[model samples]
Target: MLIEVIIKQYLDEHLDAPSFFDYPDNPPRRFVLIDRTSGGESERLPNSTVALQSYGKSKYEAMVLNDDLKKVMRNMEELNEISKVSLNADYNFTDLERKQQRYQAVFDIYHY
Candidate 1:
């Protein structure tokens, strides 16, 4: 499937609370939020931040807040290293999916 389609589907399945992403008077904006751990022990985590990046026809923007910025940056750096190791890595789609899956699995295990 196309990366955009996968991303849209993943976003639909994940984000609990809605956050808007508007880019300079655009008619439509993407709504997104990170899927993170909830309750008790999870709340004590240092990496409790959501990172959202939106892309329009001509430009892209990123927003990161809370404790998540550090974790997200670290993960991005790790992915960059992984990309360097894997010459054929499709950083855009593949990396996003991988991260999403990783987090989803982590939440699943934590909740279970």
Candidate 2:
């Protein structure tokens, strides 16, 4: 949840953007979803990955938001004493609506 909280906080403070942990019915055209994926643990440390997907009405719009988010997270590899978040992957797709474009930014997070 550290990754989720850190990402949400950053989006809130910097962009004042709408973000969610899971998909919801009729979500805003412009929004973000932070989803936790499979991960592993070594001793007491948890190494996890999360997906940050930015959605918009157009591909360029989504890309713009994702790029801005990436810039903001460039040096945030460290979230706090408990977690470190690093970018993993960047991808793009369309939502079920087809009209909604989405750009995904995945991150790997490690917690002590």
Candidate 3:
């Protein structure tokens, strides 16, 4: 459900945004990728962690998109079903070409 909500929000905000894992012949200059890389469960309760990455041609553009996502996720607790949606510190990454860059922000969703 968290992934669904996130993907929906991104699409609603950015019409031209690329969908998750959508490898095309020629990708856009800017887009997003969301994946649930890891999670934890105990006593039938679960904690889900997702990686949200904003890719861009420039460092500033990457950060700006990443920050926009962070702001929207900051108050996601309002949904009530999720116990909390918190972000860890973010880090930037660059390709081997050093021409493209991305900023990754990880979020932990405690769903009730």
Candidate 4:
């Protein structure tokens, strides 16, 4: 559970923010950990738009040169899917990255 450990570490390190990580884009963003118990539900979290942004020649070229953003986004998506399945709940996910933002990050979560 490296991802869980990493998420816990990140949360422990950054308690000021509502969530652990934020993408550096136009809009301020965070992952909302959904609690699904007693038939109660929480808000859906935003999804990372890094993959969409990485499309096109220039951005693809840049991503090829440095895979940091892509890797981060992939990890985020994996975490989101895992959380969704683990919690057995639906999520309201959205991407916040704009066309102008070359770098992107996705955030999402679910809890049981």
Name the top TM-score candidate.
2
Identify the runs in model 2 with alpha carbons over 4 angstroms from their true place. 24-26
For model 2, residues 25-92, the per-residue Cα lDDT tens digits are 88776888888887788777888787888888789889998888777666565446345667899988
Candidate 1 clash pair list: 49-68
In candidate 3, clashing pairs total 0
**What's the lDDT for all of these models?**
0.27, 0.77, 0.70, 0.31
Q: TM-score per candidate, in order?
A: 0.23, 0.79, 0.74, 0.22
Give the residue spans of candidate 4 off by over 4 A: 1-67, 73-102
Taking all chains together, the TM-score of candidate 1 against the true structure is 0.23
**Candidate order (TM-score):** 2, 3, 1, 4
- Per-residue lDDT, model 4, residue 103, is 25
User: Candidate 3, which segments miss by more than 4 Å at Cα?
Assistant: 1-19, 23-25, 97-99
Query: Model 4's lDDT to the true fold?
Result: 0.31
Candidate 2 or 4, higher TM-score? 2
lDDT of 1 by residue, 1-112 (tens): 3222332344444443223433234322323333332323345422222234322222122222212322332333232111111111111221253232111112211111
The per-prediction CA RMSD against the true structure, in angstroms, equals 14.3, 2.4, 3.2, 11.0
Greater lDDT among 2 and 3 belongs to: 2
Model 4 lDDT per residue over 49-107, tens place: 11122221244433342243223333443443344322122222233343421323233
lDDT comparison, 1 vs 2, better candidate: 2
Which parts of model 1 have CA positions greater than 4 angstroms off? Answer: 18-30, 33-112
Error of 2 at 53 (Å): 0.7
Deviation from native of the Cα of residue 10 in model 3, angstroms: 6.2
